[model samples]
Target: MSAPVRADALATLTAWRPADPGQRALREAFLGFLAARPDSCARSCEPGHLTASALVLDATGDQVLLTLHPRVGAWLQLGGHCESTDATLAGAALREATEESGIEGLTIDPVPLHVDVHPITCSLGVPTRHFDVRFLVRAPAGARETRSEESLDLRWWPLDAPPDHELDDLLAAAQIAR
Candidate 1:
């Protein structure tokens, strides 16, 4: 595992310009958490861990690719826990997006579009929080996707007609409109 991932995370957060007061607060909390736990990027960190996620859009940015998460039973953006091999948060998010969507050649925005702290019983089978750093990803034109075992379903939803969920706030924050 690269120890630089933690440093990369701290740098990413420190350089990030939060979109709102809530985002600003989360960014501060994330910085504090990283300062305290050197292993915060690993899933085994117990109380919580840093996670990377990507919200994938088509080349034209008119459509989004989402997965029906088996764990959450809801269609959500593609992303998950950072791996030992990941060197940066943006890389981790892109890696998860690729692994889960089976789509290669995706372009990622290094800056995070959102930060969220949510509690769940992850693969560890224990309750923990996910300090998710979400990035925006753009797929190549005519991009084809295959569903990986990590998801129950995978498909593209038009931005104008997204699934009923929290993607609304995400879109709003990213300033993406139909």
Candidate 2:
């Protein structure tokens, strides 16, 4: 709802460089969306909105913290809509990871690991595309987590094996980033 987050989202997308042509294309589209819509980061924005999320890894980087998102009915990483208090897209990613994981001492790579666009029904009660910027977060060694209401269940899985097959490429990118 504030200008800072929207500004940050614009700058973040502008400055990002990805090796993949596909990601590059998405990044360009996201930049265009941000430039045209002042409310790009807000839930009120129609058709599409920017969401930040993180692929959480343990200190050893061998395990990943995943949540059973009730709305999506799938095991996914921690992250959500950018809040009014967020000053940057990276901070919003960190906030979502911490809130959904209930774990402290989590460190994040400020640069995005990946960006995705997926159609879903969100709080707006209509179909929209989530322009998700994904980052990598590392939890403290053997860090304990408390389940937040946002998840149907939260747990850590071996990095090599996740409940979602779609995460394979994203997780690989995260591993390289970390």
Candidate 3:
């Protein structure tokens, strides 16, 4: 995107300090990535790029919406890489959540709830790391979700009992946000 957008993302990351030791390490690593690469926020930064994800909770706060990601073949949060139009990392998370969930008027907590860096083999057979900045977003009550092409299925699961994999970070974010 524009220089200012990337700068804003960097500023957001710079301002955050996670309580969890492991998460703090990831955040520090993310700051290093930004310092090393000016284009780190761009999807075209093949070495590794930035992504934004949302741990979305329904209005009642007891349930979470998850997407069974087609490529990853796992139930995961609503999120994707940054776009040219995304002004901030939090905005990117909200856009991805709304687009994937098909729910309107979703509100996001401006501050990030978690940060993670993970490796993935892209569709183009390129290895990349996703420096995912995770935000807590809320969907309106009774909002219906439509399945997007990116997901095998879209469903809401109880926060008290989430899917077996990748629940820890999501649960932690939910708890902290509340």
lDDT of each: 0.89, 0.91, 0.86
Error of 3 at 172 (Å): 2.1
Q: Please give the TM-score that candidate 3 achieves against the real structure.
A: 0.95
Local lDDT at 21 for model 3: 90
Number of backbone-clashing residue pairs for each candidate, in the order shown: 0, 0, 0
lDDT of 3 at 97: 96
Q: Candidate 3 residues 42-96, lDDT tens each?
A: 8788888889999889999888899998878888899998888888888889999
Better of 1 and 3 by lDDT: 1
Give the higher-lDDT candidate: 2 or 3.
2
Error of 3 at 173 (Å): 2.7
For 1-178, candidate 2 gives per-residue lDDT tens digits of 9799888888888889999999999999999988888888998898799999999999999899999989999988899998999999999999999998889999998888999999999899899999999999999987998899999999999888898797887888877776
Could you say which candidate leads in lDDT? Answer: 2
Query: Residue-wise lDDT of candidate 1 within 1-178, one digit each (tens)?
Result: 4687888999999999875898899999999999999889999988999999999999988889999999988888999998889999999999999999888899999999998998989988999999999999999999999999999999999866778866777766555422
Please give the RMSD to the true structure for each candidate, in Å: 1.5, 0.9, 1.2
